[model samples]
Target: MIFNRKFGAPGLQRKKLAIISTYNENCGNASYTHVLKVAFSEIFDVDVIPLDLFLLQKPQPFINIHADAHIKSICAKLKNYDYVNIQFEAGLYGATAGAILRRMKWLIDAAPNLILTMHRVDVAETTSLIEAIGKSVRALRAGPLFHHFRNKEFSVLYHNIVLHCKEQSARKNVWIKVHAKREHRVIRDVFRFKNVIHYPLAFLNKEEQKKVKALPKADLAARFGLPQGSKLFGVFGYISNYKGIETAIKTVAQLPTDWHLVIAGSQHPQSIKAYKDVDPYLESILNLIANEDAERERKLAKLARVNHYLEKTEVVDERLTKPITDRIKFIGSLDDDDFVHVLRDIDAVVLPYIEVGQSMSGVIVLAMEAGGRVLGANNLSFAETRKYFGDTFERFDIGNHIELAQRLQAEPLEVEAARTAIFETYNIRNSVALQAQVFEGTYKNV
Candidate 1:
């Protein structure tokens, strides 16, 4: 009995596909899996077997019998499917790197044809050994082991996993899907994987694209209880330190009085509930907002005193009439539909992220696709992803609040052409076709 099956024509028998990923969780993996399921379902009979994060992610001080059994049971079910796709991320499978690798090997053995989408492949950082050691020592002095050793461990685990994939691909049909071109080269050239696929995270399907209607900026401002004429700059996704939201806030502080900020997402649940620790990131952002507000008040008060002394008519600034804190709005976490709508509604999406070697960002892609102007830090991830976006996605120096402020005030680049280019290149149909061709042995990999 042949476990691997090729695709027939439309209306013919469909190949059975089992996707092992987080389905219902509130993570990027779940969102990616949903879109993957939707795209692949057009060609294959898709079943999304949710990876139980709650059970599998619990810290295993010793040999975790339950996690081992869980993996075995899940693998046992994969025998029924023609192909299995696992959304491979380090943290999703196990609490530790060793455990994740063991489970991954087990899953690989169970399926005849496996397609693994590696979300983050940190094979190595381009840091000097001395620099890395110094940084690691500083990180160790600060707190958790992960602060310094994360990249070291991640690189080792990723290398081992790719080596395992290269081995397995030799025996049976196995494919590794990566998000970036650099990652593709690393896996194919360095790891020597024959079957490798690379594509940006394309979430907005044709239908989703049609449904993405922009709520007018005026209406969004009204809904968020801001001035109708406010020039709203937005920073999206979870409220995390690495997002560089403080830079966005500082940018807004430096901008004209009409400028305001809308922080769309709340603190990530994991950041809050992970160690039962206080959310310092959130507190720091709030404190920055307060400081900016006080600074604004001081400026206005000085202006008022100057006007009084000169006996000149006090020209009140209409925008600063309200408290500065009011200008910075936090609407909390939004649903999928609301997210797209706000993406379109904002004046410009500000991504002041500090460099952390992120491979891709769904927010950046979605913002451009939704016809919103984007301003991101000139990080490597943004630069690489900018190939798909063209000149429409404006970039600033990483962590430069003044640069961000100046760019935000400047006229945005024309996005209609960029939008057209992105849609033509990365639409849902193209993505589905490429993956289907891979499955059918029709697409050639370089």
Candidate 2:
């Protein structure tokens, strides 16, 4: 009757962990959450409560359960569970201080043993409230600052920081988990959250890693229709603008014609409707075309007029002025197997993201498991993760196309180093063990 004593929960089989999320959403958050639920279910009796944004009542049994009002009923259903884990992002609930507060308050009233996994923790422009107020006052000096003080950025940055602080303060007993060590540091040091734990996203096992590498080397020329003996660089994730895909394409244009870049995944189904401006994918494509066509700026003008939606994948967008139609492949969304295959085949993986705030990338973790050489943007999240990365890992300035081109042209780094790194740091067994330790520690200390 002793199940998972190593977790220190001697009778863990009797305990249940409820993972609340928008269960079937197309975003990475949903996909990652699903995987975590599967991982956790092996240790604890788990339930996935379909909790999308605010609603008055359950629209088809937990599918559209209200973020604010319907929490009491959701809690009643989850009352048997020992703990509740909420997959939290500000915008996911509702992108307002009042909205997030209302939702969180509902959860607090519903469940006492709560664990919060913050996908993106908001770090204010200025750390202290005094500094924020000072900045706001300074903006008043620079001519009528009505809409936004200095910049037209999120007007509620100060508001969000305050609300987040209040949320953490109220949820002192709640276990706060973040993906990277840096996030742990930021939350603990800057925000001063006492109840915080840092563990990486659980990823592939050694066996799964072997499967990808063991899968007979992909024939790029034949399978994906690239030129023979050509270098294939890849960016593997759903298409998003901040991913610096424009930077990726621009870098590809700089490389030799034989060198091809495959945008491994399609536009995220959610992203097509998410952004207020142009689609992030289209924005990236149009930016590339704008750079390429200095004279015949027809594509640029036409695309600029488009408020939303690009029905066609304009050839000029992905080609990069190099007659590299066959070279630059926008092979739409792929299944898990194909994604792994692409990771295995690619020479190097470029993460040229502009401003990445997340603790760790699901894509980067997968690439590490597949043992692909990674060239990442110089940022804290990756820098901290670098400790666990091998010699194959390299970081360049964010949005620097030239440096990325130079690195991509270099010989592919040996995957053995990364494979070794993967086994040590990003393996599934290790992640599970860590979670067990965390779960036990939470109860023991409290």
Candidate 3:
């Protein structure tokens, strides 16, 4: 389905740029789409098409079979655009692959200059034939009669299809470039695609940057009801088991009373329930909250444990799993204005991601752009992230609660200076201009 919004003057020259993503209009995905749309509009006329591939006409025993049909329909329509930019992610085995393959086929068949943004491809996840077959059966029963395919077999098939698409595009002299540098490097070394161009993902406008910059740290602290003198540590983005929210909580539990942690993302209700079920300490906290005397004692005990961990650098695993009592506050999901407000008050941003791939980190980039110190996980992707920040950010081992606590306690001057350098290197204006340059160069070559 296509929805067109014509803005600005009618006579202005606008290059037709098609952005394709399967993301539902959720906040995180919407934020990404919004940024890209703004950036692309600044450079050319942009059309943002969100393909609804999962919608089934009828309820059935399994997943919807018409998913591939929706993808093919979207692709066939994309032939109208001057350039097609596909956002590729390695998430679902069956549906995602079908969508990607259909879109890729359009790139090959229609021969539009294609720019594939490799977002977290090559990431491994659990899969089984039974699961795939079940989903497939559900889809088949839903109408459109798509067959069930095995997960492992589908994955191999998808990878080969992508590789073949790249090769065929190159053979046809079509411009097919990739966005992520590290992923591009690996793909080049393995698949040897001559048409691949390594372009880093970037942020949006200067107006947005200015708005974020104008927010005051003191005002943000006041808004959040945090102590005026307390140092604030922030964890931004969607909370998941692998994103290391637990580690941040543990690190906060180990910090001095002057340090407060603000977890700014909405909790995944499923993951929270799962965590509570597995951790007795979490269950205990929930149980104790009902009784006045017991709750008071439990709160004190939790505070004492936090204090002890801070004083002795001892392990704080059990205390970390307990739900937020006082020191850690859940800010829930923040709008752009509110997010900037919170960032203004934050002393540092902590990214304790367990997994890393070709994906870009908005939180890390935003914190640096807003002049907040960052402490990120030491991963291959972060190594590249560090180049953008230079000395402004610190890297700690993925799950090192103790080290994170120490860094939080240390001075922030050096980190702030490093952040300034990062801002110079990765400022949205420069990054977007660089992307425009890449697009122009690719177009000229084609």
Candidate number achieving the greatest TM-score relative to the actual structure: 1
- Per-residue lDDT of candidate 3, residues 1-446 (tens digit): 01122435578666677877654444454566667777667667777766563342222325445654555676677778776666654332133555445545654565365666655545222545566557757776522223223334344543554576666665443433444566566456655555555544455344565666775446555667877776778888766555676677667667766677787876543234433544443333234333423444576677778888878554544533434456666677888756755665578888888763435576776666665678888866677665545556778898898998988887764665555544554544554454455554532432
Steric clash pairs (candidate 3): 62-138, 62-139, 63-138, 63-139, 392-418, 392-419
Q: Please, what is the whole-model Cα lDDT of each candidate in the order they appear? A: 0.79, 0.64, 0.59
Q: How far does residue 94 in candidate 3 sit from its true spot (Å)? A: 5.6
TM per candidate comes to 0.89, 0.75, 0.71
Error of 1 at 376 (Å): 1.6
**Model 1 CA lDDT for position 28:** 65
Per-residue alpha-carbon lDDT of candidate 1 for residues 93-152, written as tens digits (9 for 90 to 100): 888888888999999888878878888777665566667667768766533333446677
Clashes of each: 0, 1, 6
* Better candidate by TM-score, 1 or 3: 1
- Candidate 1 vs candidate 2: which has greater lDDT? 1
Answer with 2 or 3, whichever has the higher TM-score.
2
RMSD of 3: 9.1
Question: Model 1 lDDT vs. the true structure?
Answer: 0.79
Clashing pairs in 2: 55-66
